[model samples]
Target: MSTYMAFVYGILYLLFTTFTFVFEDAYGFTQSNVGLVYIGIGVGMLLGLAVLGSASDKIAIGMAKSHNNGVIKPEYRLPALVPGGFFVPVGLFLYGWAAEKHVQWAVPLLGTLLVGIGIIVSFMCVQTYLVDAFTVHAASAIAANTVLRSVFGAVLPLAGLKMYSKLGLGWGNSLLGFLALAMCVVPFFFVRYGERIRTNPRFQVKL
Candidate 1:
């Protein structure tokens, strides 16, 4: 789940940063006003936090209470991930095509809003799942997650200017959206088989 989250977030980070370019080139926003447009994403993130802040724990505790063994597994935290998975790709497609067609700025901003919601919800669930799964090793697991995401964040964007240039925002981000769509399966896989991975000797990490 951590590995998959890293890859997914890398793409999102790419989109987030690249939006500045989108605003400038596509919408003719000046440097001063570009920052204002980002409020849409901020609003979305806040909404995500508000919804998931209590809901994630409630879901986890409820599942644990209902479990035959009454023990909570980290997997319970991931069901919320399903919503985030959908938000991200759909948001990307909206943001991309909206920008390509030069729709209303609010349309693109709305797309960013959904992306923001997805980002925060996903981030929270991933971190919580890591903490519940690894306990003492949570920090290490997070460090690994951070490192991989950073690598992707750094490397993927280097291609942004070229990618957007060649593929255009519509197809460039759509390509990423499709990749993200495929990756949406990751959370379900974890929820279903996380224990098997944790228990299997070959899958066990050094930590």
Candidate 2:
């Protein structure tokens, strides 16, 4: 689940990194203007972090208080993904189709902001979930997640230009959005069945 979260995050970030080029080529924004436009996503990310990062813990604590005699389970952190899952695909499609159609610049920028918020929200939940689940081996789990995500982050952008060229930004980003949409199932599955999966002897950490 952590790795899958990372993969989705990697792709979202790749889109962000390449957004400057899109602004210039599609919207004819000057380089200076493009830099300014980036502030939208940056601000959006910070907002998401501020809001959702702390909310994950609060939500978990609240859940614990309600059930399990106040002993928090890792799965409690996963509910944050529900909102994020909805935002990401919506943002992606908004940005993609808006850019391809040459809509107002603010429209695409708004989409970028939504994507940024979605990324941070989902990322915080996944990070907290991994740590909560792995406990003694949390560091190792995080390392593996980082490596896989970094690999995807590095490789996916390499194809960005080709994808946009062939399909145009609309369909290209739609493809990425579709993938993110599919991944929404991942967290839901874990929330429902993670305890059983984690209880398997194979997942236990040896001292």
Candidate 3:
């Protein structure tokens, strides 16, 4: 779950920084105003972390307790992830097509809203699942995931500008959006069978 969340957010960090200007130009906003548009997503992300991040832990705990079979089903943590997974690509498509046609500013902004909310929800889901799954080694799991995701995050951003420029906003982001859509299935699969995966004796031991 944490791994899935990391990859999703890794894509988001790439999209937000890369695509904001693309939308802004569509709306005919100045560079500074475009910066502000991304600020909205920034503000949204901060608010989401504050409110939903810890709530996911509480929700997970309740679901885990309800299992009553002495085993905490990891799938319980996946519900919140569903919304995030759906919204990320939806937002990307909306933002991409809107910018391509130069639609109303709000159209692209709506896409940003979906993206911001999705990222936060997914981030919380991933973090909480990791904490519960590897209680004793949660920090280490997070550290490792963070390192790899960061490399992708860094490399993707560098390439994003060139991609958007060459393909144009619609195709470039749509291509990325499709990739996100494919990755969205990962959490669902994990949720359905994560218990079985974790049951392996190898996973029982902490790294």
Best by lDDT: 1
**CA-lDDT, candidates in order:** 0.84, 0.83, 0.73
Model 3 residue 58 lDDT score? 72
Q: In candidate 1, what are the lDDT values of residues 1-207, reduced to their tens digit?
A: 766777767876687667788899889999999989879778988999999997988888888899836788988999999867778888889999999999989998898888888888888988888888888888998999899888887888777779888999899879988987888898888888987887888866683
Leading candidate by TM-score: 2
Query: What's the TM-score of each model vs. the native?
Result: 0.93, 0.94, 0.85
Candidate 1: segments with Cα more than 4 A from true spot: 203-207
Measured by TM-score, how close is model 3 to the native structure?
0.85
Worst window of 10 by summed lDDT in candidate 2: 9-18
Q: Write candidate 2's Cα lDDT for 21-119 as tens digits.
A: 788988888987878887767777898988886787788999899987899998898888877767788888998999899899999888888888887
- Which scores greater on TM-score, model 2 or model 3? 2
Report residue 20 deviation for candidate 3 (angstroms). 6.0
Clashes in each model (backbone N, CA, C under 3 Å)? 0, 0, 0
Give lDDT: candidate 1, residue 146: 92
- Models, CA RMSD each: 1.8, 1.5, 2.7
lDDT of 3 by residue, 49-138 (tens): 776767766766687677755455556777777656777788888887887888877887777777777787777777667777777888
- After superposition of all CA atoms, the RMSD between model 2 and the true structure is 1.5
